[model samples]
Target: MRYMSHLLPLSRVARLVGQPRSTIQRMIHDGELDTFDGMVDMNELLRVFPDVRWEDDGEFRRVEEIKEKAFARRVYERALPGKEVLAERLHELGREFAAAKSLLLHYDRVHRFLDDKLDDLAERAGVDAVATLRHWLRTELEAAPDEAARAEALLAQESVMRIMSATVTVRPSGHEFFVEGNDTILEAALRAGIPLNYGCSNGNCGECRARLLSGQVSKSHPHDYVLKESEKADGVILMCSYTAVSDVVVEAGVAGAEDIPVQRVQTRVKAVERLNEHMVALRLTTPRSRRLRFLAGQHVTASIGGDAGEYHVASCPCDDRQLTLHVRRDNRPFARRVFEDLRKEDTVDIEGPGGRFVFSLESRRSPVFIAWEDGFAPIKSLIEHAMSLEISEAMHLYWIAAAVDAGGADHYRDNLCRSWADAYDNFFYTPLSADDGLATLVERVLAAHANLSRVDLYVAAPRPLLDAIREAALARGLALRGWHGEVIEPFPGAPATG
Candidate 1:
């Protein structure tokens, strides 16, 4: 399940696609992307995105907010039942929903979901104000007819038209720029040397996204998307949208970058050696011969021809002068070029020491429970970092590999943990045969560590395995939120698993 990779951080990828982190994980699991090495690049992202170019279109999306002045007024007015009666109904609704998680799960009608949720709650609680709400809205909404009329007039304002513009802003590095006439924020940001977080340019991801600082705007935000009340609370806006209003200032974060730290950089193919029958070690030497500065567990990105990808630094962390990556060939993406055509003398591009997986012995909190399902690269790097930081926590790695290659798991465990002799806690890899079949393995992990109280668990694997681990951990009363993972998921895809 592992492959040689290019170094593209999960965050930037998420931003580019306008999706939460979990969605990308699911896509990778479902094998919906082109994973050259272990990373998918801009070219690949756009290729997979069927209508990426449409993001550049100037025609505004059909959202109620296109005339937001009146629309918000309408919503605000409708939401305003008599304050006393509204409060009474809201209180009753709370009690009903609190007791009826079952009923909430079954409600299916979409357009009337809000009405259903609230109405069900009112009827269950036998609240009389529920009926009053209709009469109250009928009476109140009439007062906003003039405001709606005014909004209709203002929405047709000719001074405004959503034109595409690229915007870039760099952080911690202090770089910033804006595209004057171009409406493509992704293009503008990249053109200007700004790295803002973005995944899908189609407004599906909330990453290359930013806040609309000044001008008013509108989009199909009604479709359930990433920006929640908190992120939007700070004036956050998506960079992908053709602005409902142009001439707006955007506070750029790294996902929306003028130059993704992952873009091409010249690197030399230092060497290629065998790690095992299934894995090969590929060494890359940067052309400048200077050490690439990066935090301990971050990865690097590389590409070949006009289309290269990224992967983690498989070599020791202390040495950034040259890069080492482990390539695991897959049946789908066989590595013919990298192994056969690539040469030692030629230069290649590797950008980043990417990813947020880092370790420090400076603050030892508890024993480290490290689990890697084909995620050996980052997990391996982190374990090394923990050793370097002189962390006192007892570390355990439940590393997974094919059953036969289990004996060869060495390089990572030297002077590392309770056991130097390689009797590692190895988990058998089984093909998922049916539903609830593999949940047993995850349950076993928790059962053994029942007293693993206060442990920091780091899990990296396929989406299904991760989901099983999450469910098991929660079942065993593992307080995940405090130790909650930085992973993302597309909940809509959850039901599709069956």
Candidate 2:
């Protein structure tokens, strides 16, 4: 029997089947699953995963828990769509349900008319064949479809997904993310680690405007930036003020390192965490209206009490409202202040997210990140961003720490790296001791990679070590474009390591 075709976005399909988006994309690449215009058909999903019980899927339980307990009020509120958006989404779903029901009613009438015609023919001509035909039609109509229960479960799951979130696809970049909770398009995009161009996220700058290609959206927030009538007719909307009501496609530019303008934000000191005697993790929180916008692996200049220092941001861009920087103990004024005087709630001015050593957005190659001592800060940011992007390729991280007695850094966040390795099947972490010298350490790193041609290498170390890794990697057929290196110089009066 033919089944109605219901298409789901790739992200939604991944969520429904309890798989990572990368895993689903890999299946598509390997021809294990088929899609139509990048969307998976409900029938196709069922056929590909015949053993899956949709009714018993974890997503159903999650939705149920959300409804029953209002689980984690803060998280629940953040994950739910606003009332206006919820109403529109429900209205849209209702329209679809009504259409399907109307079609079923129409089909029922047709079946009755055909039955009457068959009865008339049988009576008029005493035709046994017409009687048999009518009986066969009635039998087929009355019998349950083989996939009835599973289809019903799938539909129920899909309805819940639609009500909870809507997928948004950016045209030129082809980045996709779900708009969940009360988040506007811009908020969702930032949270997903897709660096779409925007300024003043509260909707004053009009930098977040995009042309809608399809699907429905509701104005979730008021914007002072007015769209010209012609632009409105062309379906332009401010991403900061609109909430997606259905899966939507919009044309927008994805920002690169050069495209982002430098802005100084006054941030409050959230915490001063001492990772070790030599290093401290400075955590800062920006105001809700003015979050620092920077790609992962970039550096920002932070100032407190008239003392400033340039440090690489150690936090992922997906981490909203928070910025983390690793500061090593040194004679530098900024470092001294952090260790001696910086306190929670103290204001620190952040400026210039300067550096080209950001993640390569288009590289599908496996990423190999090598960090030397304190250089791990930027590498940490890159890894988290890659995680947020959900890259399908396996990732390898090598951190070379110095012995404490030698005045070198230790793996301060070693547990966090281990947790990531434990959480992701595709992630691998390796810690090496720099006591063996850079030559031997580099050799070990190179030896582990049998095929360098298919991997992107990102190294953060002193200039000498950075060059050594880059030269060795390139000699092994690693593409020049695939190499990203940052020279991490030691602070004044600090021992030279790495």
Candidate 3:
């Protein structure tokens, strides 16, 4: 009787039920229909659609049932030769599942026992038990990789070192930068302050594509951009995904004048003001001789007590030796230490004046500044710089706060910018709350700037907001080139525990 049970494809069921194939697929996907290897049992279909007459089309259902039985019989007869093989495979899978279950159960038991032990240890050590266990487990797990991977790692390291210790020199610009191990040519160049024309740095756009004049380079990563056979023959390489295996010369154009040099400066914190609950406005004064020269919208790496973090300069370059950074307090030890322990006259090391995320000095187009959270730091710098440059182009600032209270003062700088807007003919300011969701905020911003194609957009936000705005802008026909400045600082890692 079971052998006579008709099994039908989803398509066949959809055709018989007069429903869309997608509807049938959805039914199966949602567990409304039982499917085995893409075939549904006839009895199951009848249970699902009882109103349908099985014999409406001249005993078609019975004919399908007979065909299914014959197909099953044929499969059985064909499988007779490899019946032992099928049984053995099934047995192996059963044993594997059993083993996995046993292993997981054993681990659960061990974990519970460890938790008890950790509780006792935590009582003695005066630390949270789960956190203590997590630390130990992470340390042990990290160590586990070292012993198991040492031999293979040593072999791999040698091979990588041999090929990765290469330099790439760009033509015309004559800017020379050494490509770091495991870094793409563009990443290395960007890190070393060698500005290369790039958009969507992950190789979606071919803006970073360069022609190799001599030496060897290979694709170190995947890219969606296709290269023609002729272009390949001409030695064109996407620097965003390529790694040099030898000292190579490439025909890559530099973004701007290479006169700006990144420098390390030792500065003393002049003051730290609480900008909000989570943010601090840090002012640092460098020595007269060591004053940093940087373009607005650039960021700097600040190091103190062995912990370092990159922060965008919030102050304009015209402000001289003093650098202002909006430091957001988070899980990072450096940030917490800065907020709680850092004080006036505290010395810190600063690296950079890096990044090509600067305003197009020559562009007369209206400028739009979009910032979320502490992203206002870089945008603030850019606005000040633009005003100082006496650029008469209309400027707009959009402040997107996470919440009403999140900005510390209900959009602290929003009112200030609004006041500036009231005073200046070309300046405009708008404040938005994330209460409406990012999608709505993006729509509102887009609606405000209907001509996105003609404006220079300087977006300073976290990756999620940046990605959302970029996608929204692209969807609205905004040219990728219209995006000028960006300063993104990702979420900080957990604080180091003693």
1 versus 2: better lDDT goes to: 2
Error of 1 at 11 (Å): 36
- Looking at candidate 3, what is the lDDT of residue 159? 26
* Tens digits of lDDT, candidate 2, 152-222: 88889989989999999999888899999989999999999999999888878899999999999988899
Query: Which whole-number lDDT from 0 to 100 does residue 96 have in model 3?
Result: 50
- On a 0 to 1 TM-score scale, where does candidate 3 land against the true structure? 0.46
Give Cα-based local distance difference scores for all models.
0.47, 0.90, 0.69
TM values, all candidates = 0.38, 0.94, 0.46
lDDT ranking of the models? 2, 3, 1
Cα lDDT over the full model 3:
0.69
- Stretches > 4 Å off in candidate 3: 1-258, 404-410, 485-498
Roughly what TM-score does model 1 have, to 2 decimal places? 0.38
| C-alpha RMSD for every candidate | 24.1, 2.4, 29.7
For residue 173, model 2's alpha carbon misses the true position, in angstroms, by 0.9
